[model samples]
Target: MVKSAGYKMVGGNGVFFPILGFASIIAFIYLSFGDLLSVRYKNEINLSFVERNGTNFVVDGKLFYINGWNSYWFMDHAVHVDSRPRIRAMLQAAAKMGLTVCRSWAFNDGDYNALQITPGQFDENTFKALDYVIAEAREVGIRLLLSLVNNLDAYGGKTQYVKWAWTEGVGLSPSNDSFFYDPSIRIYFKNYVKTILTRKNTITGLQYRDDPTIFGWELINEPRCITDPSGDTLQDWIEELSAFIKTVDNKHLLTVGLEGFYGRKSPKRKTVNPEFWAADMGVDFIRNSAPSAIDFASVHIYPDQWFKRKSLKGKLKFVADWMHSHIEDAEQVLNKPVMFTEFGLSDLNKGFDPSQRDEFYKVVFDVIYESAKKKGGGGGSFAWQYLVEGMEEFNDDFGIVPWKRPEMYRIINQHTCRLAKIHGAYKPVTGNMNRICNGRW
Candidate 1:
């Protein structure tokens, strides 16, 4: 009552009316655009097998590629992740660096999904950044590979649901509770995409296979089992989902973002990514089981080279070799393009240790050379980030720019990673007699 009286004392509808109207506009954006935002890419996609004699990633007779990182443009994550004005800065930076693509993460974790924090409610302002990004990236000669749902626990991890479970009667079968099985999730995602494409510009086009603005669709951000079994083991759901995506947005490419599962696993760690069991980083999963619904694959590498300081970190060096060999294995098996979406040191402290930075640099250079030049998969790497200053602000230490920690520029932009080698290489694919066993084709 006191608040109402105070406003009434002003006795001015002129001031209050504008405030209410602005509030209404923001509310409308939330309900329609921001809350259920998704990539504006089309669903229908027609993919033809792309093969190169050497390590190269040419899609549909086009030598397409990118050199970039994962970052929120101008938006701060403590509240906002997209800021169009800040994105303008990112575009300037990206163009200067010759970066062709970026991998932005949209986390749909526990708080966002179940709406535990808001109950199926989402931040409407959050999506504005993405729309701006799509437009800016295109203007600056960069393409986007938007990671729709994030890797963080919001999208419904196994045990993170607070005694609530996603898998119930019929494993991963259609259910409201199941992350993949729920129709509501898709509905929300579809709306997210609609807002992004429709709000900004109709000429933007579908980003995936057909969209001129987007290069591809990464299904999940390093999707894996953090605590329990992934709700849907039956890929029929995934295949069907892919079909659905194809129907609505036909202008883009699609792929599952299961980072190097087998390669990162350690006899040393004992616990493998849950996806390892479902679809390991090697041939077995890449070929068919885990993600037959889409085209292409991806992985990340962040060996402990910077921490251990040992020659190859005693075990870290083996990762590049393992990844290289596996890339070949993936090509022979999956017959699709591949990209190393993330790689680099975890530490952001400028004065941590120079040797660590040097070692990290070598690992990155060597991996790109060996993998893209010699290995079969040979897509490329999008270093973990470009300018994630926020992580440093909280002392999180996982960034390359903003912090400007000497190592950030040293490792990624020191010409350590060759663009031609990383972006202009090709590899050959070898096929076997029985790709379709027992009429499974």
Candidate 2:
């Protein structure tokens, strides 16, 4: 009847024109939007998945669990240039696996380079890349917990970045307090919300706090301030940022980036980089550090690959138990639902010995599902990555992309519906931990 978003009409062949138009729409959807129909979302979660009561994510009258895998950073990068095919394949695979969500870092590796001209600028291309992903995933039936801003990997997570990031918390400095509280940052932040919310693609629906496709909008990836552990100032920054996002796009829940908690005997809250403190620093910490920030909580784990690894496969259940205990603690502390935004182990046998990857996957699934089933229940997770091709030897090869390491695929399949007849036994109790700091994810 009418054409907007660019449409032209040829009235002479109106009869056949409608047929052709309908067919084209069908083809486009079949090729890309098929999952919108095939997949189902039990429900979009509230900002409670990061909370804790007796268990984790026991908020908003829902269990709020997440079943996902990761992809390399999407925003502020050149996916159209680097890993297009892999992106498609990865999303397609997860759709088959019954995965409901996927997560990615949203900032450029240079988001903080003097705030000058040479880098980290947010623009059309960045939005375009993200637009592509939302479309692709929708076609395959997956939701997203896209985290904004990644100061942690500002320099590709170099040694110095790690040192500076940890010592100062990945947040902006007091001298640079204006960066967080500045009107400019707020404008850019709101622009980001507008970019995702207003730009409605077949997949990128209104980024409401409850849109299935837009599972959650997160603030910063693995944020850690350089100041106090109780980083009140940093937490205040989160509060302000959360308000900005909700004011514009109240359709979606918000979340603060977090790491799963620590164990009783775990090494001092340090990092694999030896520079920053692991995301979980304070005692039973969760959003207690960034309270009043978002609706959900998020964390990452690469213990086997980055930390000490005694025997992940053999201690699979133990590993699951640890995650359960830690996440539960987080929920209690933060009072929100949670998502294990990143968790991976390589079988490379280099630093921590790669043979442990498989078991790590099993443990991850067990921990996640078990966490979801219990009282508080689980939220979600994004395996380290998908399609980490040319990026091999780049940094952390966390892709579920099938290339050098076939194990990534195997492990993915093990937990996915493609081969769901089998299942891991020691499901963790992580979800029973608790809920949020008022953010989303």
On lDDT, the candidate that comes out on top is 2
lDDT of prediction 1: 0.45
Poorest stretch of ten by lDDT in candidate 1: 1-10
Please give the RMSD of candidate 1 to the true structure: 14.5
TM-score of model 2 vs. true structure? 0.63
Looking at model 2, residue 58 earns an lDDT score of 30
**Alpha-carbon lDDT, every model:** 0.45, 0.48
lDDT of 1 by residue, 1-441 (tens): 001110101011111111123343344334533522233334232333333333345656755444556653222232232322334444444544445567765433343312122223445544444444565555544567766554334243222322233332223433322444445445554554443333433334433334455666666655543222323332434466566666666556666666555422234112332223323322223432245447666766654422244344553555565466546655776666667776655453334664565576566556555554453455656765555222223122434552245554444543322544434421211111122111121
lDDT of 2 by residue, 210-300 (tens): 4445666777655544434445545566777787776777656677665544322335334212123443232223433335546666666
Quote each prediction's TM-score: 0.62, 0.63
Name the best candidate (by TM-score): 2
How far is 65's C-alpha from truth in model 2 (Å)? Answer: 3.5
